[model samples]
Target: MFWSKKNGNKSQEFQEILKLRSELSFKGIQFDKALFQLLTPLFEENPLLFKDWKDLQNKVLQAVEEKTWTIQDEIEFIESYVNLWKIAKSDELHTQLTIKGNQQDIQIFPLITFGAIQNALQLGYNSMREHPLKIRIQLSQSTLQLEVSNRVNHYLQNQADNMQFEYWKNRLEYRYPEKHQLFVNSNSNIFKSTLILQIA
Candidate 1:
């Protein structure tokens, strides 16, 4: 009985280690994808312009290792992709940002939040026509809300997009089982997603 109990504890510990490693790996991949999306266009257009890509990459990796990010970090991260969108889509893309409450040094899960931002950007780009792509972020004492919306053709609203959003929603739920809420809605001409995280 003693040996069985010991082995059971060991097995449980091993499983936990594996789960931690898997989550870390997923976080790394998500960050890399977001970085790639932000840098690929600049690299293609003028490689020399992003001579610091490797350095920026290292900074991002370090941030992931630390597992916490400040409000400035989050804003900078989102703006990177927004800048890329401006370069790639030009006149077709329009973005607005509104920040409220105190955000000076608030800490957040950069990997999870940024992953959702990347997903939203891709969805908007894929479905957007002449209408502007809109992103709104609100920071308050108790909640962080991110909303992304874009006008799309009625036919573009399909199951694949919902599945993609679901994937991110699931990740958020896993990361913050009791602290986050996600909502996605699509109508004949518009697709919108909102993610709200309760600050601890």
Candidate 2:
């Protein structure tokens, strides 16, 4: 009787292990499918995506090495990224940009700012229903700010968006430590993100 119970326990353990492996395999397949869906549009429509990204990467590296980066450079990058979205979803996405302030010589981490803008664009695009997406950029001697807003059919706020905003916040904290302040807030109807870098 003891031997039979021990064998049964071993069989149960083996079954549990098999079940865990099957679960992991199913999750892996789900992840792959999600990734394929996310990338299919870029592959099918925007064959130039890689080339454009490479060019932008080079420009960013050059700016960082030369220390000649400006706000306009960042604006252009954002415009290009928005343009890609426009090309991809021309009828679904509408964008308006308003840039204010005259300070253009302020040095900054263009990539970090770009990441923040990308997050903003994602939030805006996802929330935009029938209204146009609006982006406002303000530059000053001491601060730079960007505000993105749009209307949605339903309020579908996700932690992923907040996490993206926090990703940049943590990055800024690590890089600027004491010289920067990052704030991101969302509402039932509108999503807004603001980044202020203190350049004295």
Candidate 3:
């Protein structure tokens, strides 16, 4: 069959993708990096049928079955992804950046990205309600800049008491190698961290 036909076996492919998506969704699985990496081979053979969320879910499940990826495995993957995105989105940068000197030509540190995200989440919180922090993301050509500035009671100096923050920072370094930059500062009663990421 000609690859350009876009008809032959298309129905079967869609069925397989749909079936995979349904199974994973029922299993409450989130297709994340670890799962993807573990299942790349299965997907490599079949190729991706669709890029839609539903399609991706199916691809993920297909990989899981072939690679024996467990739900716990997917959970860990999601935990990391959520942590990264959550912090990057919520924390805000100190608006009036005081550049003391020239733009220091420093190698970007990935841990900084994780740190920046962690800092933002910590800074933006209110006990009055549940889930008070909100994070926003913007990606540009050269950098994936994240702003996580949230309204909270604590200041920059006092927010480091929690162990989770430290743990996350370490995890960031483990994941990013040397491809990230993190800047954290506060102004006008808001705690924020900016993560500038150089995509590899």
Best by TM-score: 1
Model 1, 1-200: lDDT tens per residue? 35788899997886565456546644653455554665676676777646555545555666653366887787775676566556555565576656666787678766556544555455555433456666678888778888777665454545235544455555565566689887777777666778899876
The better candidate by lDDT, 1 or 2, is: 1
**Which residues of candidate 3, in runs, are more than 4 Å off?**
1-123, 126-134, 155-157
What's the candidate order when arranged by decreasing TM-score? 1, 2, 3
lDDT of 3 by residue, 78-123 (tens): 3444443333333432221111212223333222333444444334
Winner of 2 and 3 under lDDT? 2
Alpha-carbon deviation at 169 in model 1, angstroms:
2.0
Segments in model 1 whose C-alpha atoms lie over 4 Å from true places: 1-45, 52-56, 90-92, 125-130, 153-155, 159-164
Q: What's model 2's overall lDDT?
A: 0.57
**TM-score of model number 2:** 0.63
> What are the TM-scores, per candidate, against the unseen true structure?
0.71, 0.63, 0.37
